[model samples]
Target: MTPNDPIDKGDLLNVIKWAIIGIVAIAIVLAAMAGFGQLNVNNVITLLTILAIALPIYYFVMMLRSSKVTKVERSRVKAYIPLFFAAAIFWGIEESGSVVLALFAEQRTVLHIGSWHFAAANFQSLNPLFIMILTPVFVWLWEHWKKQPSAPGKFSAGLVFAGLSYMWMALPGMLFGTSGRVSPFWLVGSWFIVEIAEMLISPIGLSITTKLAPNAFRSQMMSMWFMADATGQAINAQIVKFYSTDTEVQYFLAIGLVSVVFGIIMFILVKKINTLMEGIH
Candidate 1:
């Protein structure tokens, strides 16, 4: 067919129909499992989280296959798939500064220094505060540095740092024990580390999303970046249930290890991912 000819819609329609059927089937099975007592609240949420991550990806792949997308475009988008998940995992930890970290600040941290006292809610400001402080420094660094890591490399490093933030929280419980209130610096430090990860992942991820987007689905691709954050928070809703005074150390260690391990795995795959990116550095 000529380049001017309209692409066929049949494949796209079929993909939509199949995707809906598949999602419905998975949801029904999960619900049935819950009804039969095979799934607890956490189990249900975990599976639903997988579904949340997978569904959009399923549609994205189908759309690419059905459309008039080029090989180069397809490869770049494929490269973006792994990065998307990495961003989601990073966001899961980063966004939790408000929910999980805030809970820690309120319930576990000692909120005073010397004669100074502050609200636990005030701790939330540390995120934006650190971002503001670090942004210019990082901008200058990226500009002056002749060699920088690829987006995937930055993301991998970001995940490690994100994981370390959680791991750092585990230390307060470990060193001082999990019962009494610890110093507020622990919370501040965790926020500081995760915000560093945010600097590595957030802006870089946004830039790479624009660079990698297919011309036909430019807007949708950007939406997918936001969707990554949403997906992370959705998963957090389930995992955060496991956190409490007694489970504090275990919770932090578990989530932190997961992020760190995934970061290492991503690092190992960097060369492969770079190849998939096809020169969009």
Candidate 2:
């Protein structure tokens, strides 16, 4: 495509729609299989094992039939190594911090105070309700901010927002006295604050990946983006398993602190990375 050519936005939308449909269809089929007792845990494991073995062989065969990469492209790929590491570390810290916090809250003595279970279930609706209420206000604010010449720097702002969200959770613990029963509002508020950070950073991160990766390696680059998420989840699970104890709250607090620290570091690196990305794009 020529530099001045307009992007086919409709075609992009159609591709996205089909991808979502395919994912949903696969999910439905998997659910049906499990429901029918044809897809037990063992069956799932076997399927995964077969796929894992087959994918590399398939890819290698495709490569053999295709032209080899030149040294210049190889160096270009190597240049992304630091970006990948930074992305992975950032994701790992953020997710692991969340796992720690959730575990901490879980370790809290179940308060039978004032219909706690019912309140907790109702609290699940709190976020959606807040979104429904605040969305218009948020949109207006976003538009106003967009018009400003000095709108906040995206990555730095996102990290600051994340830190603020963690602080929201921490504040309730301090205010209510950790041993005493606290309001569910604290958790809900914290979630809402963090969701804002998510809305900001997630899309920007994806945009950065697409802009930076070479055309030939774009798919692999996207896969690595998601792999960072998977890696974070795996690490979270392992950390939770090892740290399971009455000290879950302490673990969570520690994780939150680490997240804040790493987020600050990420914010510091944003300018350098953004400069690198400008050349790549």
Candidate 3:
């Protein structure tokens, strides 16, 4: 349609509704923060971060409910909803590589290997390093494995692996005690495991997002894929506050188990979720 074409009344009204909601939400957050003396740079950044994640998700839901979305498209979008949340949870753990995990590397682990000292920050490189190493291996495996899992199945497994990565972190604190530094290998092992989870979820998630997208909202669905990452990081900002040297083991176990339990539930409901997919697989 040309720019000169009149905007539909319903569309204009919907846009206005969202604009008003956003303004009020921001105002409320700011007022609450100011009241508590928490209206600072970091807290404001967190608020913006959550908004960035939430808006796209809200938009995606609205898109699915649009009159242009067909019955089958609506069903597929319904199936996509579970996957989106699964992705968000998976990412919350995976993205913590730079935040919670970084803190572990810096504060908990011994940053030396037999007198060859290194920077704790160096541990961050393990994420991309492992991704490069694992991507090709997974690319080959997916081609040769004949009976690969569906996207939902892969996402479930990814969550388990991501959970295990945190569970691995809990062990060093559990065995060695959190007051003293443990081996840096603990961080190494955790990064390795989470990267394996990424191999399952990241690429497959991108491909599946494309497949599951309703025709009218194709590009918007891809944005929804990225919003999962934002949502996870936004959650990370709040949850990371709970992660300290004092609460090391409990924090790791709590978040880890949540992902694992959700994953197991998803696995049990795989058949039901697939049915909702309406043969997209």
Better by lDDT, candidate 3 or 2: 3
lDDT, residue 254, model 2: 64
Once fitted onto the true fold, the runs of candidate 1 whose alpha carbons sit more than 4 angstroms away are 1-51
Q: Please say which candidate is ahead in TM-score: 1 or 2.
A: 1
Best by TM-score, which number?
A: 3
What is the C-alpha lDDT profile of model 1 across 1-281, one tens digit per residue? 33333336995798699889988998898789878998777777777788777866775786479465688989988999889999999999998988889889999999899999999999989988999999999999899988899999999999999999999999999999988999999988999999999999999999999899877667778889998997898888888888999999999999999999999999999999999999988
TM-score of 3: 0.88
195: Cα error in model 2, Å: 0.9
* TM-scores for the candidates: 0.84, 0.56, 0.88
Misplaced by over 4 Å in model 2 are 1-153, 174-177, 242-249, 279-281
Model 3: per-residue Cα lDDT over 1-281, one tens digit each: 33422458997998799889979988988999999999998888787777867676677678777987888878888888888888998899998988898888888888889879999999989989999999999989999999889989999999999999999899988898889999888889999999999998999889989888877777788889988888888887888889899899999999999999999998988888898888987
lDDT accuracy of residue 231 in candidate 3: 86
Among all windows of ten consecutive residues in candidate 1, which has the lowest summed lDDT? 1-10
In angstroms, the error of model 3 at 40 is 2.2
Please give, for residues 1-281, the per-residue lDDT of candidate 2 as tens digits: 34322337895798699789968976886788889988876556554544444443343344334344344444434434444444443454456435644554454434344654642334445446655666666567667875431111454455555656656666655655566556555666666765565555555557666655555555666676566555545445545654544443455466556656666665676555545444553
Compared with the true structure, the alpha-carbon lDDT of candidate 3 equals 0.88
Number of the candidate with higher lDDT, 1 or 3: 1
